[model samples]
Target: MKIIILGAGQVGGTLAENLVGENNDITIVDKDPERLRELQDKYDLRVVNGYASHPRTLEEAGAGDADMLVAVTNSDETNMIACQVAFTLFNTPNRVARIRSPEYLRAKQRLFLSDAVPVDHLIAPEELVTSYIKRLIAYPGALQVVTFAEDKVSLVAVKAYYGGPLVGNALSTLREHMPHIDTRVAAIFRQGQPIRPKGTTVIEADDEVFFVAASGHIRDVMSELQRLEKPYKRIMIVGGGNIGAGLAKQLEIDYSVKLIERNLARAEYLSEKLQNTIVFCGDAADQELLSEENIEQVDVFIAVTNEDESNIMSAMLAKRMGAKKVMVLIQRGAYVDLVQGGNIDIAISPQQATISALLTHVRRGDIVSVSSLRRGAAEAIEAIAHGDSANSKVVGRAIGDIKLPPGTTIGAIVRGESVIIANDRTVIEQNDHVVMFLVDKKYVPDVERLFQPSPFFL
Candidate 1:
């Protein structure tokens, strides 16, 4: 696929890195020559230095025959216009834009038609990050929670703790622990290294365990690896930006929510917009302000301020002040590894969420959803099996018979409304949604080819 990406920032750069190795022709556009040069130096792709929305820039980036146009520049207006320009002047087949403004997103149904913005897909990083945080909040103690197969199945990551029922036992004991619920251990990470799980594999404490099961059975499976946590009730958020305000608005009805904004004007506006949330105008890092708000009684403290340093400091302070859990929104990928598991309970990355969303559209075959895990080292994919035994490699085959790539595991199969946990004897039928985990991303192309029908198939 020949793709033109409009942006040299984090999202654009990361997307280029992912696609360049996947046999796609990637060209990145940006006004900053330095950013373009950096990408060009690091990867085997072309880079165009010009205003992303300009027609001349698109032409230089080879948009005329590009398979897709991805506009992810920082400015919402720029991204929307670039998509329109790509569609009108270049006739690009697929146009994906990263739109941040809520006003534009709220009216996207009517605003993004062919006669309007011409954006085929809209990527809202703020909305994606907010939804990601909401899922984590819904299942306490989960390091990561991503759903697939239209929410019928979920992939959850949690750390195995001491004294848990299945922590020190072999993988085969999971069935004895929970005879009623069916689940599969996708992959295990011990000290940042991937471990292919076997029936005799014993889960050790502090091992990050990724598992897949029916959405309703997620909590039951999580309890086997760690002590189940009490549902969260009191929530405090630092930052009045889109993610913070949106989370507060959505969670206020169910949980006691409070928001702290450094800017007084924005705080007042949020106070009017949100009915149940308490809006405070003060510095989130202020020790006195956190104490005055009874931080010790807060169940969860989330710092989503734009500044990474501020979020890390405030979340650390909250944890030190006796907050049960602290979740911080970190922009830089490097900082995510540094802060998480130290003072912060979870470090949410907008880049990862955006990349995951973009990959869903870029992936080949019948893939419906893609979730990046372990910071892009691993991926969970939901792909619909098409064709039959004569044409497709996966369809009409048993789980153990399929030749999956190294470190790839079939976690579950979603057929119609039923979620079936994957086993060696389970046979994959036509139209079944196969949920898989890849511990190594280099095997993505191999996995994609497995679902593709043979060329001779009618």
Candidate 2:
């Protein structure tokens, strides 16, 4: 596939890196020559330096025959216009635009038609990050939670603590612990290294374990790995930006929410916009303000300010001052590795969330959903089985009979409304949504090929 990406920022660069190694032709466009030169130096792809929304720029980026056009520049207007230009001038088959403004997204249904804006898909990083945080708040102790098959099934990541019943036991003992709940251990990470889970594999303390189960059974499975935390009640957010304000608006109805903003005008605006949340005008790093708000009684502290340094410092201060849990939003990849598991319980990355949303469109085969995990080292995919026994590799095969790539495991199969936990004897039928996990991302192509239906299928 030939893809022209109209941005050279974090998301554009990361998307190019992911696609370049997957036998696809990737070209990135940006106005900054330095940014283009950096991407050209790091990867084996072409880069065009020009204003991304201009017709001349798209022509230079080979948009005439490109398979897809992805417009993710920082400006929402630029991205929308670029997608329109790609469709109107070049007739690109697929057009994806990253739209961050809520006003545009709210009207997207009527605004993004082929005859209107011509955007095939819209990726909203703020909305994605807000939804991600909401899931974390729903499941108190989960490091990550992503749903598939229309919310019938969920894949959750949690740390195995020492006191948990299944922490020191072999994987085979999980059945004995919960005979009624059916779950599959997708993969495990011990000290930042991937561990292929097996029957005899014992989960040690501090191991990051990823597991899949029916949505109702997720809490039961999480209880086995760590002491189930009490449901969150009080939430404190330290930002007035899109993610923070959006999260406050969504969570205020259910939980007691407080928001702190350094800018007085924004704080006053949020105070009026949010009905249940208490908005304060002060710096998050101010110890006096945190104390005044009774930070020690807060159940969860989330720092989502635009500045990475401010978020890290405020979250650390909250943790030290006795917040039960702290989550920080980090933009730089290096800071995510540095602060996670130290003072912050979870590190949220907008780049990863945006990329995951874009990957659903970029991936081959009939993949419906894709979640990048462990900072892009791993991926959880939901692919639909098509064709019949003769034309499809996976349609008529049992879980153990199909040839899966290394480090890949079939975790669950969603057949209509029923969620079936995958076992060796479970046979896949046509139209089943097969959910799988890959510990290594290099095997993504192999997985895609395994699920692809032959072209001759009637």
Candidate 3:
């Protein structure tokens, strides 16, 4: 696909890097020469520097022949204008804009009601990252949230302790303990490639385990496997940035959030901005000071410090001090490898998450909304059904009859308001909103055909 990306900042730069996987003909446009230089140095792509709103600028950037134009500038106004120009002047097939002001996402339904600008998609990275924080709190053990088709199923990650019972046991053994919980252990990665764990494969201690389960039975599976008691009540956050503030505000309702910052001005700012959480001004790295605040009692310790090393060290310290779950946001790629199968529960990057979400929507035009889960190996796809699907060869045919590919399942058939888990007998009715759990990317079109009846097939 011929793609044009406006804004070569942190998010856009990251997008350009990830776009290499698709090997799409990509052109990045921005006003900063240094950032463009960095982008050029890093990725195999063309870079243009100028105002995206300018017609000649976009034309020079080859937006005219572009299949997609993505406006990911810091300013939402810039993104909105760039997308409009791409549509009206360049006639791009797809246009996406990233809006920072979160309220726009909330009022998107009414704001974009007229469709004045043909912005096909809108991304809010902060909102996306905040949702991650929410998911972590909701399920303390799971580092990543991978929701499957119809939101019926989810894949959660949990780190097993050194002397846990599940260790030295095959994941299949989980079924015997929790028979009622209908879940599967999809893939386990301990020493390299993803292993479809069998009855004989012994799970080692300190292994990061990824488990798949029906959404309803998620809790049951977690309780059965982990067995570690007590819900995480008190939490300590070691940053006062937007991510920290957003996470604090979102999680403060259920859990007691104590936000510690070194800057007095920033601390006061947080105190005023956030209502429920207690904002304290002090060096969070100070061991004595942290101890005075009873950091040892903190059930969940989150290190979202601006510096990657600080966050890592803080989280490690929290773990040493007996914090149940520790999560850190490590932005740099090199450092990410350091935490792989390491102590910290999760090491997330805001930039990576944002760029990833944008790229996900860029690839998934047919899927109404898409979230690439399990580190982009699997996709949670929501697509609308057409009449052709109901009259296809697969229709009235049991799933077993058709060569249903591995790791692919019909998550739910959303007829209306209700979410229905699909069974072999369940028919794909026309105009149904079909949600699918797709593992192989090549079979997306085939999966789409399964929902939409094709006249040729019947």
Candidate 4:
């Protein structure tokens, strides 16, 4: 579980802290001695101050023994080159690079099977951020869309709006209406954390919900609830850089897209590459220009400019001006929570999104505790509750009998072919898939034992 991270910038720093805190042996590499020193001071790991793409640098940082090498420097080329060095020179098993360019993204088809660009994963933050906003509009009431444990299971987040379909209905009552669904309400997050939802746990307006189901059930659940029924046609994206271009390409097949950028040269260049998208050359913050372009009638407005404040302000203006959905792409984690909680429908962080995607497959030993904290887009959590095995102390007990943690909500249990949502009297069957909310990684063992009475891991 040794991970070497290149670039101590926003994304790299966030990844290092989160992964290291999760008990992985992490080493951060950067040219900045001060950044490396600062990370070393804060966390318990090795920090190497050198160019990660150099052989001597990898030797100094011990990348030869690293389980994975992460190159996420500000420079996309640097990050890619760093990954190449990690793979070629250090012979690292896994190599991940942070690519912010649209050309590389579009070249993914060519690179997918090519060893020249033999990266395990390439993270495009702008694409991820814009897609989040697209998902919100595509599925109106659903609060989240998360792929869990290898995309076999999808976790959908929904908000119970006033007069919403399931308002004031019992979880069981709601399920009776929709038959043949291979999913469950799992755990409900009301008043916060996981609760033994009773018949009286009425689905109120704005009550955030997480539903775990098979991937195919996504459209079914959203369609039944009158959310995410119809796909979008027109999307207006502000900013013509990597994010806007990436979105334009990703969504062009289904939607008529427009991209606005202040830089005429870039806009003209983007226009040449994109066929379905119209590149507009104007200041995105300009109201007159937006109106001239019919921004109000658009289905989704994505503010993905490099400036954090501009993105937030533009998202607000887009929402106020009558765009159906607004999304802001931000690198800083601080603004994500504030904006999402305040008014922004979707807030996507490049660094966090990349980390969440990476962690979905990177589990060491018996630990299964990587989740999308979502800073606030959709809620996707992964946890292993106690089973009948030696590692799990509790089995065949009702959820009500377990000593649960604060801010944690149990969502679903994997029992054979079925993933069951819990009621107070719902018993924890043996070898169940117990999913919980807000469960911290540090106390995972303690939390695991709480479900089943056990002495300790022997």
Give the top-scoring candidate (lDDT): 2
The per-model lDDT (C-alpha) reads 0.93, 0.94, 0.72, 0.69
Candidate 1 — which pairs collide? none
TM-score of structure candidate 1: 0.99
Expressed as tens digits, the lDDT of each residue in 54-104 for candidate 3 is 898999999889988888887898888888888888888888888877567
lDDT of candidate 2 over 17-122, digit per residue (tens): 9889999999999989998898999999998989999999999999999999999999999999999898999999999999999899899999999999999999
Ordered list by lDDT, greatest first: 2, 1, 3, 4
RMSD of 2: 1.1
For candidate 4, give the lDDT of residue 288. Answer: 80
- Residue 121 accuracy (lDDT) in model 3: 80
Q: Provide the TM-score for each candidate, comma-separated.
A: 0.99, 0.99, 0.81, 0.78
Against the true structure, candidate 2 reaches a TM-score of 0.99
For candidate 4, lDDT tens digit of each residue in 1-458?
Answer: 78888888877787776667666788888999988888888888898888878888888877889888888888888877777777777788888877877678878768733278668877776666666555565555565666544455667777666665677777666567777775566445554444545546766666666666676677776554434434666788888877677778777877888888889899999999998888889877778877887877887788878899988887787777777777778878887767785678777777677776555445442335455654522224555455464544446567776666554556566566665655557777554556665534455334544644355633
lDDT score of residue 117 within candidate 4: 65
Q: Tell me how far the alpha carbon of residue 348 in candidate 3 is from the true structure, in angstroms, after superposition.
A: 1.4
User: What lDDT is reached at residue 291 by model 3?
Assistant: 83
Error of 3 at 382 (Å): 5.0
Residues 1-458, model 1: lDDT tens digits: 89999998999999999989999999999989998888898999999989999999999999899999999999999999898898999999999999999999999999999998899988999999999999999999999999998899999999998887787799999999999999999999999999999999999999999999999999999988899999999999999999999999999989999999999899999999999999999998899999999999999999999999999999898889999999999999999898889888999999999999999999989889899999888999999999988898887889899889999999999999999999999999999999999998888888998999996753
